[model samples]
Target chain A: MATKRKQRMIFVIVLISGFAAATALALFAFQKNLLYFYSPSQLSEAEVTEDQLFRLGGLVVEGSVVRMPDGITTQFSLTDMQGQVQVEYTGLLPDLFREGQGIVAQGKLNASGLFVAQEVLAKHDENYMPPEVAEALKAAGGEHPVSIPKTTVE
Target chain B: MFTFLHKYASPQYFYSWSASWQKWASIIAALLMSVGLYYSLLNSPADYQQGETVRIMYVHVPAAWLSMFGYMVMASAAIVTLIWRIKVAEIMIAQCAVIGASFTALALITGMLWGKPMWGAYWVWDARLTSELVLLFLYFGVIALSGAFDDERAGARAAAILTLVGIVNIPIIHYSVEWWNTLHQGPTVSKFDSPSAHPSMLIPLLVMALAFKAYFFAVLFKRARTELLLRERNTSWVKALLKEAV
Candidate 1:
């Protein structure tokens, strides 16, 4: 009975390790596809056709927001501090949307190398503090720590 | 230690022993939950960026933590069941499935509600969200597999194997935001050295997490006791229990 139990334990370990190895390999192969969005740097490096729909994510470049004459349409530039992409969208933005905020926009590129976005999502950082604390931080010339690195492709 | 474990491993001993602790756990859970609610809802300050909606983090984060925690418990119980063939551990796997699924559902719902205003979409195919959804499905799968067989032990063994296989998803769920370009933000409180949340907000969140943990134990003990009673209905202790009730 002891030997049987030992054999069973070994069998279970082997089964689990084998299964985990297979899954790790599969996930590794699909690593690029698993990313929700591509950085501006990745977008430039990848061979993306104008008609291909994909998500572009990065910081909304400070002072790049332009509200068109039509109230709905807005244009902005996204940057990873290494590369920048111009994005235009016609939709109501989230309340969190603002210059210097990270955001992900999904759409296709146009003929003039402009990204025409169908949807845009605001991506807030991990920092959370009260308004008073934020004011103090700003007064002290400190900024909210950015958790997501600027040029992370994965 | 072995003797102590052996004594408790007996379902009859465990059934009786768990009753007193179950009462204590529920009382503690209730007390903690009240304090947690007060701190989270009224005492905590509004976030600089998210305003009042950040209060949702108290519920959402705790539920998410419990969801993962429940799975870890189930996986540990699975190991015990498979290795020692412990009847109590087998029962634990079944109980953990239902509880884990409920927590997973709660986490997903609260996350979606929080996501709508902040992220502009109620749902997204982001890595963290997607993996959590998979976890919910994995719980459902375990529950279904455990109930499929006529012999309870056989069903439990099958469920145990499945639980072990799905254990890989837990790490994926945890590190998804860091590993992939997810819309979900990275770790906040988990960062040991430099937590991103302020003390006021962090304190409430921690209190709520403790409350959830207590609640989990309360429910687990109660459910496990009932299951033990049912499973041992033909045994002498349960027969005596029934006689005493009469």
Candidate 2:
């Protein structure tokens, strides 16, 4: 009985450890793509090459959007309130895109250090800011912004 | 300790104890669920950003947590059955698979609804969502495998082994948001020194979580009772139980 129990115990350990190893390996291999986009502040801190593609996120500061008269290119200043980056995109933005809204832009930095956006995502209601944008703002300003209150219920 | 555990293995003891506990658990579950739902739907403050849609968190978080918790319960039962040759644990695993699967489905559906407004898309094949879908499949596999064989014990044994192997998915489901750049948001209430959600929202979310837990066990006991009846049909105790009912 003792030997039988020992053998079963060994089998259980091998079974669990083997699965854990597989999960660890898969997560390790896919680590790069699983990462979320960087914020303007994070982009500034990192040593990303000008041509390297990545994600940048934050709020579109009010009145910062400029549409080239040609009507294709739009420029906007993205900020976490403490630090800011200029983003340039040449495409029709999501319908919900507006000033003071949170957004995530994907593309590369140009030689002039301006963000040349490939695609932009924004579909938030007037009152809502993306949680990611709020988090980045908190990190950049070193204080949780009152814009996203912890709760409204008294 | 061994004898104490083995004592409950008699099936009769477990059945009687579970029957008594089931009523109380159901009452607590009902009371808490009603109160939680009231606060969740009517009173809890809307998120500063997500607004009314943030209300989904009340159901979404609890359902998500229960899915993982149910899997753990099933996996632990799988381990107990293998190690000690416990019959009740096998029955418990079968019941847990059903309950866990329900919660996983709820989690997935509610998550998609919540994501649509916040992320500008209903679905993303990201780490968090994919792993949760996989967790659902694992539940399906266990339920199917446990009933696959003509020989009952052999079927149970196979299902138990599968569960032990698939248990690795639980942690992956939990940490997915943190580990990857998924569209899904990160932990708000759980990781911080204090919950990130405010007092009004946080309180109800917690109440809902507890309500789900109590509800899981209440339903678990009922299913386990039925399982014990079917699986032990030939035993003298079950025969007596049926005869007494008749």
Candidate 3:
């Protein structure tokens, strides 16, 4: 019985120590890379550097979109009704791309602190908007466009 | 609640409690899943873009969520078992491993079905995919470690250690999209600012997520109760419990 208890104690100690070590190691490695999601309003207020690859999500600002010299490249501003972010993207866009639509841009900040989007994903329908966009809009005092009607999506 | 939980730390007491919970949870799980699937498949709006592929999201996304969730549950149980020396915690760790691994496998398979048409490839070394694959291996390693030793107690302890070590990969998996230039899309629901999912898509996703959680609780209760019974078979309470069941 004494030997059995000794074994159990040793096992408990090893397992606890192992968890502590792993958690410490993980936190140390990811200290810099875990970027929190931010709105344009928050980004403007906060101390954001030009090199961070952070996420900026909201509706494509109406009438603020412009095509660059290259037809494939487009520049637009995204807004949450409170603040706005200038974004540049050069790629084939999703079919739903349009002004007043929701979009999530993934990329890094440029030397000028402007967002250089690697990808731009647009909402599929007039009624559809990303939840993040809706939340930001709600926070910015805008009402959500779509209500659950009697009809379901089948 | 703390005092209530404290009593069930003993394997013998936990076995009886879990047995009762298993029956209730299983029934609830069946009910919730039936409603969730019926509503999601037949009533939810078809995607204007992806069409039927969006349906795959109902299964794939929730399975992925549960996969990560399962690992978290297992690892947390492992931590509790080791720190508190609670036998019931070990049972929970073991039970969660089986269930979590199954969810991970489902997520991968459903993802493949969705990816073949959407991404134009069945498999790619994207950050999200790779991290998910690594998670599968971690599950396997934990499962394998549990059976390695002749002594069940020693095996459980070793597996608990492995589960703890493997949890380091969870953060890496979650942040892989941000850290690397991956083809996979970033998070849609689990952020602070805005979720990138539309209300039509978002409501179903949330409902499905809840359904999956319920299913997990149902299954884990069953497995944990069985494990407790097995581990404490020699105890007097277990014999009485078995007699009652029979």
Candidate 4:
């Protein structure tokens, strides 16, 4: 009986490990496709056509937001600290959207190499603190440096 | 230790032992939840960026944590059922499935609510979100598969195998943010050494997490005890216990 139980244990372990290994190999094969969005640097190298829709994620470059005369359309530059992409979107941005904040935009590139975004979503980092604590950190010049520089103050 | 475990593994023994444990767990869970709610909703400072919307984390994160924790418990019970053919472990799988599914559903709902105002979308097909959704389906699958078989033991064995197979999704859910470029943010509380959240916020999050754990165990023990009673209805111990109750 004891030997039978041990055999069952071995069998269960082997079954689980085999399933896990198969899943791991499958995930590895489709690693690039699994990425939610491509960084500005990756977008530059990829074989993207004007007609293909894709997501671009990066920091909103400081001092790059330009509101069109119509007041609905906005143009901004997104950068991954290595490469930059010009994005134009006409919509209400999320509450967290601001200069130097990270965001993901889904859109297609136009003929002039401009990204025409249909949707813009803000992506917050892991940091969380009260307004006062943030102020204190900034005063001390020891603010938690997100990927982008803390140049714009809300 | 083995003998002790074996003794308690019996439904008759566990039924009596679990009653007082359930009572104590329920009381502690209630107390902790009250305190945790106070700290999380009132005492905790709001996020600089998210403001009051960040309060959603207290519910969302704990629910997400419990969803995974419930699966881990089910997986452990699955192993015991497979190897030892423990009757108690089999019952545990059925009981855990309903509770785990509820928590997974709660996590997903609260996440969508939080996402709309913060992430600007109600849902996204990101890796983290998608994996968590898969966990919910896995829980439902376990519950449905177990109930599908007429023979209870056979049903449990099948469910246990499925549970073991689904265990692969747990790590994927955890590391999805790091493994892929996800819209969801990375780890905050799990980092331990240098958590990004302030202590005021982190403390409340931890309190809420503990409260959820206590609540989970309380519900699990209650459900398991009731299941043990039903399963052992023909046994003499249960008859005596029922007589005593009457």
- Every model's TM-score: 0.97, 0.82, 0.65, 0.97
Q: How closely does chain A match the true chain A in each prediction, as TM-score?
A: 0.94, 0.65, 0.56, 0.91
TM-score of B-chain for each predicted structure, in order: 0.98, 0.96, 0.93, 0.98
| Candidate 1 CAPRI grade | medium
Off by over 4 Å in 4: A143-154
Mark the 10 consecutive residues where model 4 chain A has the least summed lDDT: A145-154
lDDT of 3: 0.72
Give DockQ per model, in order: 0.76, 0.26, 0.08, 0.55
Superposing every Cα of model 4 onto the true structure, what RMSD results?
A: 3.3
Model 2 CA deviation exceeding 4 Å by range: A36-63, A67-74, A77-102, A106-119, A122-154
For A1-154, candidate 4 gives per-residue lDDT tens digits of: 8899889989998989999999999999888788888888888677799889999999999899999999889999999888899999998888888888999999999999999999999987888899899989989998445544121111
How good is the docking of model 3, by CAPRI class? incorrect
Error of 2 at B197 (Å): 0.6
Instruction: Give the best candidate by DockQ.
Output: 1
Better of 2 and 3 by lDDT: 2
* Every candidate's lDDT: 0.91, 0.79, 0.72, 0.90
Residue pairs in candidate 3 whose N, alpha carbon or C atoms collide under 3 angstroms = A131-B195, A131-B197, A132-B194, A132-B195, A153-B44, A153-B45
Using TM-score as the measure, name the better of candidate 1 and candidate 2. 1
Ranking, TM-score, top scorer first = 1, 4, 2, 3
DockQ of 2: 0.26
Q: Per-model i-RMS in Å?
A: 1.3, 7.8, 10.3, 4.5
